[model samples]
Target: MARRGKKPKGRPVNGWVILDKPKGMGSTDAVAKIKWLYFAQKAGHAGTLDPLASGMLPIALGDATKTVPFVMDGRKVYRFSVRWGAETTTDDTEGPVTQTSEERPSRAAIEALLPDYTGEITQVPPAFSAIKIDGERAYDLAREGETVEIAARTVEVLRLEIVDQPDAETTVFEAECGKGTYVRAIARDLGRDLGCYGHVVELRRTSVGAFTEDDLVPLEALMEAAEEGRERLDAEAVEAGAKARVVDFAPLDDYVVAPETALAELYEVMLTDEQAARVLSGNPVILRGRDAPVFCEEAFATGHGRMIALGAIEEGAFKPKRVFGGRG
Candidate 1:
């Protein structure tokens, strides 16, 4: 007997789906929804987006799940709006207002502050974030009404441009940054720098790696497609045919990028059939023809128009660190 609302047995759908994650939904909940809609036997996300922040959430299905780490290492772009005059406990709208300031910085004052935030800078992760403290989540500690002091870490901020100043209370901006850079922390710091308490009122992630806003599929659209697939399967079952328990929501090859695409930043090596076979079989292969890139510890090996494995370049040899498809 199946439990009510339990998702049916899923299919091994290997690919990635860019979800324009709606506002007010946790990253975990969004993943669960995407999984159910696709009925994928395996699924994972490249990065976590808080409930308050919406936009691109890269969902990987089946074999694509193996490429998540590579995707997460890529740069992220965010368009966020900060509301001045009040600082929140969480550094976002969810927390209570902790401080308020009557003085708001003019556009010129804000523009002058921009140069200081760009490039490599130290940033402290917000107390209400997923960062672990003493093996427990920092947000968990914060929710339990505990004071969480996070250490400052260096994060590269590639671009920080003021896009708009709609009113006296809010300012909109776009940011391009590296992994581990916290927008909440930026808002908090900006507030302090300008002598006006501020917190993020709205945030939307525009891109993650090669996945961008153009690739995003709305949650409702995916759900509708899945429901239609279920109906078709039920009809087939009535005709004594096996029920279609699995569905590939998007064309894996056409819509979802190949695994090599995610490792664009890494040096790639093309392997012969025999070399690929050995690499996939958990064995190292010698690259006799060319010298490996200097300091190239990580690489992607490709063969037959597909990614074979992610490996380490050690001693002029490609040592398979993690193969794409589990086994040869």
Candidate 2:
């Protein structure tokens, strides 16, 4: 007989965790922490949030990782504060100040420029960004003391408004925009247009797709929950007088959101056991009845409350695009 491969460590936990990522932590680091907390076998994030920014960072564990692309395409809402009178190389407080201006714009001047940024607009990304230049990250090049010129691209900004003005030197604005929109770029451009060079001093993301501020769970809370769960497990093992006991990971279920939450915008179809089996086997099923969707570019199916697959509908037939399996 052929030798069996070593089993992967950790449980096969599946779900989304809308982490309220704190500043100074990278997106990848946050995902690693969450994966360890649940002892999950696999994990990924929907969007990349910088170390200088905080707020909703949707992390997917196990099977939920398959839906990362959908979440990445969802709208993002951010509230950031810009400090006038100086421009930094990174377009944020993280970089050195390269320029300074004594000019300060009135509230009315800021309001008038909001319309220009709203709707479809062309904007250049910050030099210290993740954009690839000749297969190398732009930020890496910039850090190496190399000048990087990123091309301008069009991004959709649904809404932009001045939410607060703390003083003559700072202005806070909130923006709702589509994928690829950078809040740092907005602050940089606004400062330049107002004749007072500025850079982002504070940033916070409040929403992404189906996730909102209400769903955010601070990192401290997750760590505390994990520590408490481990303690409870140890106590139970002691009481039972067992030398060895299997670890139970059910306590952290409360923090895990349904995987379907990321695909809220897609239509959902309920499938029978046989139909679900077919879908899991990489086959399509014919949807029946008058209420069945005739044509849909993207949709999902569930069988007995378990997600079956992500697929497309054509002439009432649901074609499985990506089938899910092995428990959520």
Which candidate number maximizes TM-score? 2
Cα lDDT over the full model 2:
0.91
Task: Find the 10 residues in a row with the least total lDDT in model 1.
Answer: 245-254
Clashing pairs in 2: none
Query: Model 1 over residues 59-124: C-alpha lDDT tens digits?
Result: 898778888998999999999999999998999999899899999889899989989999999999
Output candidate 2 Cα RMSD: 3.3
Off by over 4 Å in 2: 1-6, 232-246, 326-328
lDDT of 2 by residue, 147-222 (tens): 9999999999999999999899999999999999998999999999999999999999999998999999999988
Cα RMSD of all models vs. native, in order, equals: 5.1, 3.3
Each candidate's lDDT (Cα)? Answer: 0.84, 0.91
Candidate 2 vs. true structure, TM-score: 0.93
In model 1, the number of clashes is: 0
